[model samples]
Target: MKAVHFGAGNIGRGFVGLLLHEAGCEVVFSDVAESLVQQLQQADSFTVTTVGQHPTTTVVEGFRALNSDQDPETLTEEIASADIVTTAVGARILRFVAPSIAAGIAARPAGAPPLAVMACENAINATDLLEQEIRANYQGEDLEEKALFANTAVDRIVPVQAEGAGLDVTVEDFFEWAVERGPFGGNEPDVPGITWVDDLAPYIERKLFTVNTGHATTAWHGWAAGHATIAEAIRDPAVAIEVETVLAETSSLLSARHGFSEDDMASYRAKVLGRFANTALPDPVERVGRGPLRKLSREDRIIGPAAALAERGLEHEGLLSAVAAALAFTPEGDEEVDRLQDLLRTTSADAATLEITGLAPDHPLHPEVRALIAARITGP
Candidate 1:
């Protein structure tokens, strides 16, 4: 078997890349970074280390890079030939990978075998979104055998490890990728390198509510406090309380919507909090909160649950307040800040809040966001 994976970053090498290699698939790492690409091509292998729940290092071999830009011809052939394709590229770069996808489709040989493109992103609708962008340029039989875009929910704490020469990646050994196999079809959870599940809603809701939401709450709350590390930040009562409260907000909506029993949900939430409280993990709050803009998007962590609550006629004051705090993150060189500033400056408070936060102007949570902004903004 052969696999072509996008993104050679930490998650790429540590999770997806290593898993594929172990599953007995020849791996072709696809990335845009020239240095990393060259390194993969030159070395033919890399190393992955799990930093959580029993740290261990292992060498991953029989892999090389397919420089999509420089080696377009090869990428096209590989895409057609490969049995499976996966992506770890942050959702924002999904478009940039479209051309390579089109080329690969064009390069598929006659009677080419079916392929799957599993986009392992933090969002719920990632695979569908990628298929849309990838199909914009595709047509005919190529479109018919068009790869499957499997919606996947991945969970792990892969903190940006210490930078150095080796390819060792420190990540939590506890990881999960629940792909939306749908009612008709689902992922092969039993598959050596994949976990297929029917009805992605439950799995996604569980992971996001537990990992992403809980983790971000720690970040925003942590950033508010003097702590830099996630473990340190959660040590503060205020931060811990805020995280627990937000999780409670999400847990209520989740249980009501998904039929997760209150008892089971409580246990799950406790497990998530325990993951955070593991000082041994030493996950940094800044790293979790680094890409504030992406993390704050309507489809991403903070806004996703908020939108869910709105649809079900539930109150999301805590969620909206968290988003309001996210918008206040004025980090230098962040495009989201620039975009948000424009929206805030050009629109009324109601419209600005809705526009950036993805809630309707009349959303029940909108007033809370307005109040949050008011209390924080020092108006003359």
Candidate 2:
């Protein structure tokens, strides 16, 4: 079997690529970075170092690189004939890659075995969104029969590594990649380490509300506290308390919404917090809090669950507090952060809130967020 994966970055190589290679597939990584492409092309393989109690290194091979910009024909051809396709590119970049995917699906040889397309992103129904993008450009016959798009919920911590690490990726040992099996036209792809499920909502929400929400909570709060790394920020008593509170709020919401047992949710929250505190990972607060615009959006980790909580008349103060911290996040050198600050500066509180988060002025949680941002501007 062969697989063509987009993005040869940390998560791509360490998590998705590693698993795909272990599943006995020849992995072809497609990226726009000339340096990274050349690195992957020259190096026979790279290393994956898992950071945890029993840290171990594994050699990941059976993979090469293709520069998507320079080699569109080869990329499309690879995708056309490959057994499967996957992407770890951030969700926002999905649209940019959609044209290539559409081209590849169009170029797929007739009567060839069906292709499985799974988007391993942090966002909910990422594959569905990617498929929507692909469908926009597709005008080919029997596209549905020719391809399967499976939505996936992937949870792993692939932090930024030290400079000059080359293709070597250091990541957390704990990971989860769940895919909805309902989309498959026939037998599901037998990729090991993936949990195939009929309904993916529960799993997706569980990971999003627990892992992502908790991580963002830590990052925003940690940034507000002027801590450089997640380990340092999480070590502070106040920061840790705020993170736990946000997790508690989201946990209650998740348990109630998804029919998850409160006890199990509690365990999950604790485990996620433990991961955040792992010193070996040492993720920078600025890196985790980089994309403030997306992070502050309504459907994202912070506001999504918070809005649901408000609709339920449940406790969401912790999440709202995190929102305030996010507003205060002005990490230097991030263009998005600069733009967000400029928007917040020029617009009214309610207007800025609506524009940034897609929430109406009358949204139940809108006033709370506005008031929090207001408090940050004026002395409480």
Quantify all predictions' global Cα lDDT against the true fold: 0.75, 0.87
TM-score of structure candidate 2 = 0.96
In model 2, the runs with Cα more than 4 Å from the true position are 373-380
**Local accuracy of candidate 2 as per-residue lDDT tens digits, 95-118:** 999899889888888898788999
* TM-scores, each model vs. reference: 0.90, 0.96
Where does candidate 2 have its weakest 10-residue lDDT segment?
A: 371-380
Model 2 / residue 108 / CA error / Å: 0.9
Error of 1 at 211 (Å): 1.2
Model 1, stretches more than 4 Å misplaced? 182-190, 310-315, 341-348, 373-380
The 10-residue segment of model 1 with minimum total lDDT is 182-191
lDDT of 1 by residue, 232-290 (tens): 88778988888887888788888887889889889988878877777766776667766
Cα displacement (Å) at residue 252, model 1: 1.1
- TM for candidate 1 is 0.90
